[model samples]
Target: MANNDIEVGSRGSLPRKDYFEPLPAPMIDMEELAKWSFYRAIIAEFVATLLFLYVVVLTVIGNKTQTDPIIGGNLCGGVGTLGIAWVFGGMIFVLVYCTAGISGGHINPAVTFGMFLGRKISLIRALLYIIAQCLGALCGCALVKSLQRDRYNHYGGAANQLVDGYSKGTGLAVEIVGTFVLLYTVFSATDPKRNARDSYVPVLAPLPIGFTVFMVHLATIPITGTGINPARSFGAAVIINDKEIWKDHWIFWVGPLIGATIATMYYQYVLRASAVKAIGSFRSTPPTRH
Candidate 1:
């Protein structure tokens, strides 16, 4: 009867167990040095981040220029706020789809850090990805400045700033909550159990992540220019060289990182139940002298 009950339950329409990977042991191995694919992954992150910032920042600059009567007038009608949000969300979807297999498609440092804390990536790889992303962002912003030259200055160079009437505390909170939404979505979308259970999920994976970015921007842009990615904010700050940007710059880094850390902990421990096992392990140690 117990065996029959177990069988019947298995056949029922109940949800299955959540997927969770074992925590990765830290290592610095020569194999990573020997692998060509590691370098390729780094390059993918660079290019993806570069493309992301370039297109999005260009849109921002163009919008500012168009709205300025002294410059564009009615000719450059601009895409407006809604269009800017779409550009950011759309670019992320396309980029993630293209680079998911090779680089895990982490275009943001905060995302990479979140994955690192979750043990989804190695420490070495995480560090490298962050460096590549920052460099890529710098190059992207530089290109926009180079092309626009005069307009870049007039339009504020797409720098993220705390707008009038909003306090720094409010700005910081926006980045934190906005980034938590994005990172949490990435975790849930890529959860192995979710994919194993639903074959159709792979095709729709990027959509929710992109939509999260879009929605977050719509709510937070007026407050802090929607800086969920630290590298993106830093890139613009470097190029614009504005003291105000520099003063509030720490909020971008601190907020997103805090959000990512929280997401990593929640998804790994609570949602995935990764700590169910407390078994001990043994490893060989060097012999001690007498």
Candidate 2:
């Protein structure tokens, strides 16, 4: 019944109507998204830094009042220098957990500069982070001053300085070693291979790192009031306006930077090589695409 000499297969096919179906909205550029994410991270870092400094300064002020009451009394009124160390260590732990994913939780400029030196961050990014951290610290100090303008003479806000008998060299040594331990723990805990399971690390990372800061403060508090973090010291010192404190501030910066640099390099090159090798081997395996 078909027409004779008509060949259905001989006709070329027409395009499908669905070919004009609306395409999904264009996807965002991942590079632009990453840049935006990084900007957010920096802002988070600023917020974290402000919170950390505020808590520390307030604690120091509180403890100073506790200690000052008993000049020569039978009872020791203050929690003592060791207690201050614990305060700092504990605060750091809480802050890190709250902001680690967002900003790598570097509330300290020394830590940031150290990471920068280790090539973990780009120069421009590092610069931005440092500015944010410094500004945050300054703002925290300003807040303390505003709140206690009438009580400044009594509180002093936990500024750091060399003890009466301690020399500059001794203070520097303490800071370097103390910061080395703190930063080493930071590198280890945040390291993907070291804490391969994210759940385990989020819980475990803060303890050791926090305790290390506490222990370091205990050992060095007598020597330099334990200014392992220059930002912390700077925050308090600016409010106190002690010229001597400002003069000695360079040691805190230099020591922590040196220690962090060494620790980061050791972690990146020596400790992580095996993990790197494993990842490389996995990538090199050819896939059997069926």
> Could you give candidate 1's per-residue lDDT for residues 1-290 as a string of tens digits?
11111111145566444333344636454577679999999999999999999999999998887778875466448888889999999999999989888999999999999998887888889899999999999999999999988888777788898899999899999999999999999999887666656656777888888998999999998899999999899899998888877999898999999999988888877776555423321213322222
Cα deviation at 46, candidate 2, in Å, is 1.5
* Candidate 2 ranges with C-alpha deviation above 4 Å: 1-34, 70-75, 197-199, 273-290
For model 2 the local lDDT of residue 220 reads 88
108: Cα error in model 2, Å:
1.1
Q: How well is each residue in 220-284 modelled by candidate 2, as lDDT tens digits?
A: 88888887787788777877887777888888788888778777777765775533543453344
Tell me how far the alpha carbon of residue 286 in candidate 2 is from the true structure, in angstroms, after superposition.
11
Q: List clash counts for every candidate, in order.
A: 0, 0
TM-score of each: 0.87, 0.78
Candidate 1, superposed: residue stretches over 4 Å from native: 1-9, 12-30, 72-76, 278-290
Residue 239 of model 2 has an lDDT of 75
lDDT of each: 0.84, 0.71
The number of the candidate with the highest TM-score is 1
